[model samples]
Target: MDPICTLAVVGAGTAGCVLAARLSEDPNTKVLLIEAGDRMSYFTKIPLTPTVAQQGPYDWSVRTTPQKYSSFGLWNQSQIIPRGKGLGGSGQINFMMHGVGLPKDYERWESLGFKGWSFKDLRPYFVKAFGTASAECDPEMCSADGRCPYSSIRFENKKAASIYILKNHRELDNIFVNKEIVLAAGSVKTPQILMLSGVGPEKLLKKLKIKVIARNEQVGKNLHDHMNTPVYVSIERPISITLSKIFKFNTLWDYVWNRKGLLSFPPMAGVEYFGNSALMLFAMGSASERLMRDLSNYKHEVFRKTFPFHHSSSKEGFIFLATCTQPRSRGTVSLSDISTNTPPLVNPNYLQNGRDVKCIVKALKRIIKIVSSKPFRDIGAKIHWPRPERCQSFWNGSRTSKKIPKPAKTLNKDLVKRTTVAENDKKDRVKMNTGNNFVSDDYLECVVREVAVTGHHAGGTCAGGTVVDHKLRLKSVTGVRIMDASVMPSPTSLYPNSVLVSMAEKAAEIIKHDPAIHHDTLQKTTDRRGGGRKCVKHVRQNGLQADQVYIAQAQVSENKTKDANRCGINSAFYRKKFAEVNTIKTTQQCH
Candidate 1:
């Protein structure tokens, strides 16, 4: 028989690996980690080849439902949301830019009634996850500092969580967790996993003919992501990254043998924060027509006219990628069927909110301001704005009379309904005194509606306060927890990779000390082959007839706290009683 573990973690992504490593520190407690994707391979190991890795077998390459407001430039108006499928998961395929996010980001979560999730509460976890290493010491590495000084990412140790588990804890391989099952399958898929396991919206489960273990209305509700629009700038110098420079024999040799040089470097050169959002600056590198076509999906005519020198092998330009980090718009993940094989319908609903569009436009103006400075002027940098026909009239030097386009009609129908005609007219009244070099706000808004794409930082589907409690446990279910990005109340102001790692570290600590997990009710022998079905069958066959007794005891305990306020009584007390009584009843039933 396979050995029973104290905990079972699903999805061997960054968070799952972290849990497996941290929890397995107890020599007596075993851990079982299950992954749906293929194991790690050499293809995903390189630092600079994230796009290449994304194209490989390990990436889910899931496409979102056609956006009603945005992604007009993308193929079929459906943005591709790439998710890493293998052991290391997205950590292996991401740009390697680690961001812990601003303090306000977590403060917002605390404001939402997530008591222990403030930045102050989560700081230690960040320190614990990143170790003593300094990413800033390495020229190639990039990471956020100031508040999270210890947080760092290394090119060589990119797969730190996965590597730690595979190398350090080989003995805990043959095991299955009897106590608890934790889902860390990322934001996009974790909810699907929960729904498939019969813990989801009751109506949906009934419709699909699946058993309802628990009715969680918020399982797949709060889906949101940072959307970015890349603004390319043409430069006189060949200082930017190019295909010719990247494919050089020496460059490959240096990365493969010495583990240094351009090939080992991260794609994003730098990041600049603007309030809660950010502008990620990186070289366009391979400006070839084919590569540009694949990356942006803008019309061929627009690309040809805007980036005329893109056909050349030289460093054509750099991209000022502006992202709206804290978008108000929310979307969802839902199932059309019961099978886990079927992809969950992901609708990010990018730029659905007017605020998100305005935020991106503000960042674009900032990019223009920066490029106008002496430093950029010295490099002869010029913005290559994509002239989609709709936005062409509002261009800086358009031959036609420049009039501020009616944004209300151009935007989403819902957004249009919310904004009165007076409000739109008021916004249009802002002086079109934008210099001959600058375009009007109307043009930028249209550009945002056309060109924005997913920043690949999707989260908040499961969400803390709704699907799971502050402790990361599923509120409706017992012995199950979610410790991935799905538990985040909102998508952070920056890259969520570092924040997710910190969350995993904190979750490990919570699981280690939580008294509820140690109860006798969870110690029953689990069926290895049948998965959750056997456990559910075991519970049904044994039954929780002692629930009435526990309820009586809970009532008695609650009465002791004047007027028997439900909040006054510790929920843990009821859990302990339920566990003890159920254990006894199960034993009696067996006899």
Candidate 2:
């Protein structure tokens, strides 16, 4: 007999592992956890080299369908959306920047019919899952004893400057939070799981031959992401170098001798910033106290060391100005085929919204201004990709290209020349259609069209309430549920891992007491109750068998006399008499 398990959790990434571990706490419940990839313990736990987590056994490198809005056209290059297949999910590969979403973000969910999912309500779960070691503590916002690990990177230099930048920018000081799954599997895998589990558009599922459990047309729709265009500056000296080279020969010896140096830091140490005014306000004030506390508790010891000050670069250093905010552009995730193992079709319509262009442009300007401050006058920073001098030209070209009008064409000259001009004019009707028009606008339109990219934050496939009902249950199905970031009604400006964790935590709680928990067992018991009805059928069959046996015995007795007379004298006459007698006897018995 197959072993029976009370709960079967798939995908041992952040949410999966956490759910399994937490649910298994009850000794009575047996949990069967399945992961498509290998374990990610070593890769996830170590703080030194998180970037390595993107490759090897832990990563699930998924590709997207070619985007229509992009300049590459139908045959454009595909986008690669990576999610960790191993344990801890994308959290193992993430930059480890802990931040909580704005409170208004959650309130928006409440408005959308996702009851009990408001930021205010979900705060405790986030606090319960993580422990913080950062010096700052907002008890209401954070917790000290949580199962999930939380810490900040320590810096070696310019602590004051780092603090100044964070303090001056209220937006950067916003706290991040997490609770259950950590949902760090990134954008690609989250929606892929939802589509595979039969919770997406009906047309896409039918095309893939997947039976539709729920007909949510909006499952993979409305995917939006933040795209970062790197502006590099050629530094005269390398300000930040890895410990791998500095301690090459004696690296192992140093680590063994003392647990110190560059080996302790995470990859790509950086601070979060919001250039968009609306986002800045939302991050600072719109969020709840609990979320703020959870984020404030994260101690970035590594970030503090790497980005210590506004002028914390080498004698000549580069600054990575990222546009952390995004526009509300949407896309989709649909099934490629019916096979569960096959990946889904992902289409993240990045930069489809015009506002996103404006946001990115604003972010670029902010980065230029910050680096060109009076304190950095002597450092002499230069914008590498789009030089400061070309800002005007770039902006102008972008604007002009967006507004170019369609060209107008008159009827062919051949028709006009063949007939009298007046007669031709009277016969022919002018057609006004903007079907084929080449943009002759400024340079920015062409450039904007050429440089668009994705931020890799696709979401809202199994969106809460809108697609799936509030209990995380599929709106049309009884036994299914969606626990990934696809359940998010909308993508948050901050990272989604923490939010996903909290959502999973809530899901796990609900599952523990769900009616479906005993549904199978109850069904089996009911089947046994109906088993008695089969006995009546067996009795009827037995009666029919007995009647057939009696008829066969009577026929044998009747034939015995005819057989004996056949061997004696007058065999033909005897046989004929016997047949006649039998027929007469049969007719008399029937009467």
Candidate 3:
């Protein structure tokens, strides 16, 4: 008899590992945790450098199919989609920026029929999983004494500059939250795990030759990611501290000896503003002014208290931020084949919707305008990678492609004519067409194409209700459950890590209350003969009859083909090839 484990968790990624650790707390439950890779404690918990955590026993280095829309028509040149294969999963490789979704975002989940998943309902779990942030916590936003540590690092040059830019843009003020196994394993591996364990499209499983344990068509569909346009600014002073330069002897020794210096901060740090309903209601217009005052008061308090390093830096550095809240576009993840060892295909269909393009352009223009404002003008910031001319060229190229004639010159003239006509119209036709009122169509499309990158927020594969029920149990299969980012009903606008943790925590509670161990079924096993013991006699007879059929066909075909081959000199080679082909055909027929 095969050994019976109380529970078999297939992945040791963020969600899987968290489930393992939490479920094992019961002690009576013997959890069989199987990781496709290695342990999390294998590497020391060091920040900034992810290279140490990305290879050998830890990573599943999956590459995406060339993106259908990205990088100004250049295909497959976007950054490689790397996901962790081992314990702790992407939490070990991620740039440790702890964040949570807006409260309204979770309320939206409740509206979608996910019971016990609203922000208010899930708040305690988020608090239970994270340690208190050093920054001031809004009683409504942050939690204390959670499983995962949440604190701001001592700001180095890059982090400090980024914070300074974000402070002026008071629109971004959401807190980070997490609980249980904060599923930080990222986009690529989340769906890969779901499909590997038989929780995806039924037709895909048959094509790959995997057993159909569950038939959830939405398992690997509706993938979404946030794309960022890096605000590359050339600082007058040489920037000594960066993730790449942190390994130098001085920096390494300081970290090794005192656990301080540039190595303490995460690889990158920046704030984000949402363009969704949450941001518009609280952080825009006259209401935004009141929030800004509250934020300014909070910053003053933060500076006075424990964090003295929150002050702005004089040296110039780059700023990177998200362009929009909840991109309208979506993509998918699917199995490459039946092989469990092979990585599944990851395809984040970026810029599929025209609104996503407009949102990105509006966000970019807002950042540029903010940086050029009085608060940052004294700092002497300048656009580095995409100079104004490059931005213009990209806009021209996008417009040229959209015109009736595919050529560049014709498109430019057409766009100019269209712009003049739209400006003259009283009803504002241009605003309706471009989605965003501020930016031109050509400019918006260019930003979307050029700045496209993964936000690493992928979900809805093992989606609740539509795929699996709210309990996460497979609708058609017994003794199998899904507990990863794929289980999200929809992608939240916030960082997915905290929400995933809440899911694992809630799933653990659900499992404890019902105990999946006492289910009323046992898995059937196949014997050495490749059939159940009850079918052994019938299977043997079928095999014998199949063998007889193959022999009879071979005897008749071989004699007839050999006799016909005697007509020509090249017939020997033709006969040999024909025989080889016939043999394969006969073997297939035998089954």
Q: Listing every candidate in turn, what is its Cα RMSD in Å to the true structure after a full C-alpha superposition?
A: 14.7, 29.9, 23.3
Which residue pairs of candidate 1 clash?
5-176, 241-285
Model 2 TM-score, all chains together: 0.60
RMSD of 3: 23.3
lDDT of 3 at 557: 29
Question: For model 1, how many clashes?
Answer: 2
- For model 3, how does the per-residue alpha-carbon lDDT over 1-591 read when each residue is reduced to its tens digit? 322234544454556544654554443444434433433432325664543555444555555676667644232433344465544555555555456677877776667666667788778877655532222112221111101111111112211100000111121111111111112234555455546545568888788666555577877787766665443443344442433344468888987798687765554555647464111100100112122212212223321221121233332355444355677777788877644345567777777787777676666555544555664556564533332332454332233333221222213565556664434332222322221222344654565565445555566655666655777665564444567776676667746765666667677677756633433222434335553211112211101011111100111122322212110001112111111111101111111
**Tens-digit per-residue lDDT, 31-148, candidate 1:** 5555545544564556666666564566877778888999776678887777877555666667777778889889989877667988999999877765532211111111111010
Query: Which pairs clash (backbone N, Cα, C closer than 3 Å) in model 3?
Result: 129-146, 129-147, 130-146, 219-461, 462-486
Name the regions of candidate 3 deviating beyond 4 angstroms: 40-44, 51-57, 72-79, 132-199, 208-211, 237-240, 243-248, 277-316, 385-441, 515-591
- How many clashes would you count in candidate 2? 25
TM-score of 1: 0.75
List the global CA lDDT of all models: 0.63, 0.43, 0.45
TM-score of 3: 0.62
Indicate which candidate wins on lDDT. Answer: 1
Q: What is the lDDT of residue 336 in candidate 3?
A: 77
